[model samples]
Target: MQKKILLSYIVIILLAVGISATTFWNTGYNYIEDENNEHYIRQAELIANAFELTRFDSANDFSSFTKSYADKYNTRITVIDLDGEVLSDSEVEEQLENHGDREEVLDALRGEKASVTRYSETLGTDYFYYAIPVASESFTGVLRIATPFHEISNFNNSVKYSIIRAIIVCVIIAFLAAF
Candidate 1:
């Protein structure tokens, strides 16, 4: 009877340890993803701020400014006018047909930062879209930036590896304790 009780306790403890380790790993993964996303968003905002300082003589001048600046971060920037027109874009020479209707741009037009994620048909993968209001006094155009999903996905995989390592260490400790 005593042996059976000891075995039961050991099994329960090992099960608990496994569960705890899995939980810890999942939490860590989520934290890493969240942190990476926040950091990238901040980087996007900094780019927007820099674009604000370029002193464009008119809205048309914004095209060259966005192209030159956004290229550094592997992102595409779209400058949208208050009327929802694409005033300038980093990737395309012609105006985007759906510029004004885009949610991120609309939110920026309302003086708010907006971000969204969606699958890109062109890239054959997902991408994140970030939009923030340009700090211009007269125009209410938005600066929308896009980054491919692989940026975050790669970071996520790294996070997953770290969590798996931690879980393995925890499982080993649990096994040692059981023995």
Candidate 2:
């Protein structure tokens, strides 16, 4: 029957649309994630190099330096000494717990560049973190920079919604064409 043929055609079209949409969504998500990783890594390296070039006379000087950079970049910055002491944080004034056990920090301490996305207990939020080893005449430590995870989530949500809308439009078009 014509009705049966039309129904089959519509079903095939819907399946194709669904498959394509899924592939697009996954590819977009991965691309965004990779871009973010590269961006953060470059930022961390730049900040670390800058830190290595500077020598702060006191803790206040160190804190002030990091605070300025954090404000400029709209991010959280922390300097942790080799002994795991929190020398300074752009966001926190009080001395917080040691970061030696942190995965990214640990990797940085071993002379490796590292990055991770996780919840920060101190800040009580999820963040994308990047860390690098930095050394200066007056300081030797790890420099870490973090940006809120919500930025990535917001972009991903927009892409997902757009894809969903596109699938809806395609399904409607396919149905009409098949009929």
Whose lDDT is greatest here? 2
lDDT of 1 at 57: 81
After superposing candidate 2 on the true structure, give the runs of residues whose Cα lies further than 4 Å from its correct spot: none
Tens-digit lDDT string for candidate 2 (1-179): 98888878987897899889889888988998898788778877888888888988999978988998898877889999887788999999988999999999999899888999999898888999998889998988899999889987887798889889988988888777776
Q: For candidate 1, what is the lDDT?
A: 0.76
Report each candidate's C-alpha RMSD, comma-separated, in the order given. 3.2, 1.6
Residue 41 displacement in candidate 2 (angstroms): 0.9
Q: Please give the lDDT score at residue 128 for candidate 1.
A: 86
Tens-digit lDDT track of model 1 for 9-37: 77787788678867976797788767766
Candidate 1 clashes between residue pairs 3 or more apart in a chain or in different chains: none
Q: On a 0 to 100 scale, what is the lDDT of residue 6 in model 2?
A: 83
Question: In lDDT terms, how accurate is model 2?
Answer: 0.88
- Cα shift from native, residue 87, model 1 (Å): 3.2
